[model samples]
Target: MAEDFDLVKIMESGLEGAEYNKAKFPGLVYRIQNPKAAFLIFTSGKVVCTGSKSVENAHKAIITLANTLKDIGFDKIDLDPEVHVQNIVATADLKTNLNLNTIVMALGMENVEYEPEVFPGLVYRIDAPKLVVLIFSSGKLVIAGGKIPEDCEEGLRIISTEFDNLGLLS
Candidate 1:
């Protein structure tokens, strides 16, 4: 997290597509169109970048922002800043229909939350990878909260293994 940023100067720099409304939100929303990422820049110099599918893309986005800040006369801006991956989202397909009721019973009530009336997907919390996997009846899955791509892969493997062992996969 970068610290001690001059948010006011950044806002005054006439950054194209930069939205800063202190009354609406505390942070400035800077949209980087090239890498296709939105950065939530705070007065404290802390930036939260989202919409990046990979770490490389996130890093590139930050670099682009840093360059823009430098070009706008922002002092002490780090050109090569350290980028941290806080979360990763991934999707997968089981290639077969799944029964939410049976999955809930098999995975246990504590780990599974299936409410078709409210949502069609079953929310499965995996403790090992520390991620949440959304299992759908259409055999599609969405894994989120992973710090790395490997975490998503591991979470998928664990869930697939568990489902396979229980004969849940068709």
Candidate 2:
């Protein structure tokens, strides 16, 4: 059956507790904050993606997550289109810190219009709908505008949260 869901929500929410453990088993595993929404991806092409949400969203989330990994350049895995839903898990929002200016610099100024600040760092807009706040290497980002601050906050949050969940937070 075709899975139904807002892929962006699933991806955004799922990314909260997702992790990538290169040392543990040489692959990626997403331990969604929702206990029921957890899964493991082994380097050997074995996957155990389970969640207790609407069976449709659960399946959709897994596929969306899996595709995201692939897009992010994770090791190849033969994904089963017929994904199975074992349980549904409650959703939890994981906290994170994102430095938009730094990210923009990292991504290059070609994508943004750079503006100087007296406090240090830079500010820019994304697609004209989002305001990005960036600090020097030592500063944290403070973003405003857009549907929400997520676009700005997620970058840093993903790295830390993913590392933490992968048992590499230290």
The most accurate candidate by lDDT is 1
lDDT of each: 0.90, 0.47
- The window of 10 residues in a row where model 2 has the poorest summed lDDT is 85-94
Candidate 1 residue pairs in backbone clash: none
Worst ten in a row by lDDT for model 1: 1-10
| Candidate 1, 1-170: lDDT as tens digits | 45677777788889988998889999999998888999999988889999987888999999999999888987678999878889999999999999888888877899888889999999999998899999998999999999989999999999999999999876
- Compose the digit string of candidate 2's lDDT tens values, residues 119-157: 555444445343343433343444443233344454445
- Backbone clashes per model, in order? 0, 7
Q: Please give the lDDT score at residue 134 for candidate 2.
A: 40
Runs in model 2 lying further than 4 Å from the true structure: 1-16, 20-28, 32-36, 74-80, 85-170
Candidate 2 is scored at a TM of 0.31
What is the alpha-carbon lDDT of model 2 when measured against the actual structure? 0.47
TM-score of each: 0.91, 0.31
